[model samples]
Target: MARPPRFDTDQLLDAAVRLAAEGGPAAVTMAAVAQAVGAPSGSVYHRFSGRTTLLAEVWLRTVERFQEGYFAALTDASPPSGGAGGPGPDPARAAARAAARHVVVWSRAHRDEATLLLYGAQDFGRAEWSEEHIRRADSGNARVFASIGGLAADLGAADERGRDRVVLALIDLPLSLVRRHLRAGEPLPPHAEDLAEECTAALLR
Candidate 1:
């Protein structure tokens, strides 16, 4: 029987994540990743075709992980009552709070990954990736917008366009705030989470 693969894909990716986090995408060359993981360069090539493929995989994996955690938190925060007799929590408030907290907490916890993802452009160079990857990114973004739209409608925002503006403001404002702190070489503002939550609430209202 053929033997199973020796190195774990997750382990390799974790090392790559740390490297990218510490040194940016430019630090994620195959040689660098291999050195970081103490693995032979051939191992990286065996798993990924090239630098583009490896970087794409790392970027997509990081985004997916964040999305999964945020969505799970939203589900968990759901109210224990209502909604078709299912045990799931009421999604409205829970979803909003969870979304806000998720972005703030995840960004702070993985500042390197966040910075790499937001700032580093993954140059696919016309290489076609799996449709699933595209869908995953789109769907996660859509969910955030949908949640914001629902909240805006609840608060009687003038229209869909108005709701979209509010959504953009809520999401982008916090990220910009964090980016400013990082750029200034200052510690993240202690009230960052509070600011996000308050901004989200106000937009919804």
Candidate 2:
């Protein structure tokens, strides 16, 4: 039987993430990723057809990984259904807090991937990708919007304008904070959770 290749797809993507984190999307060429992982250029091409495809895979994989945990946090921390029969404060508020903490905590935990995602994904040409890739990207975005949109409704946001405010408060604002810190090569402080939660409260209020 033939022996396995020296490097796997995940390792190449991981190297791409590092490159993206260090120098943004412009640095994530196939040669660069292969060099970072000490693999032959052919190794990268074995999995990804070219730079755009490789970048799309890298962006999609990192985002999916992050969203898995983020979505879970949102679900697990959703406010209880009824005070008479369940426990907890307002579900919307609880969900908001969970969402906020996930932004900080997840970024701190996965700094390279998080940094790459925050800075490079959209820049790496999702718009020019193949139809299937575009569909995948669109669907992923739709799922996130749907999840957060539901949360906004549950939070008593009035309509589309109100939902936009809720999303800006809970998702965009916290993510902006994380993006800034990650790009600066700084770890999010332990107090980031508290800061995010407090800010979310203020924004929603």
Clash pairs for candidate 2? 79-91
Q: After superposition, how far is residue 83 of candidate 1 from its true place, in Å?
A: 25
lDDT of 2: 0.80
Error of 1 at 164 (Å): 2.8
- Which tens-of-lDDT digit does each residue in 1-205 have in candidate 2? 9998889999899899889888889999999999998888998999999998998888888888888877876766655232122334676777776777788778888888888877645698887777888787778778877888788878888788888888888788889888777767787877776677778777876
Off by over 4 Å in 2: 77-88
Q: Lowest summed lDDT over 10 consecutive residues: which window, candidate 1? A: 79-88
Error of 2 at 32 (Å): 0.8
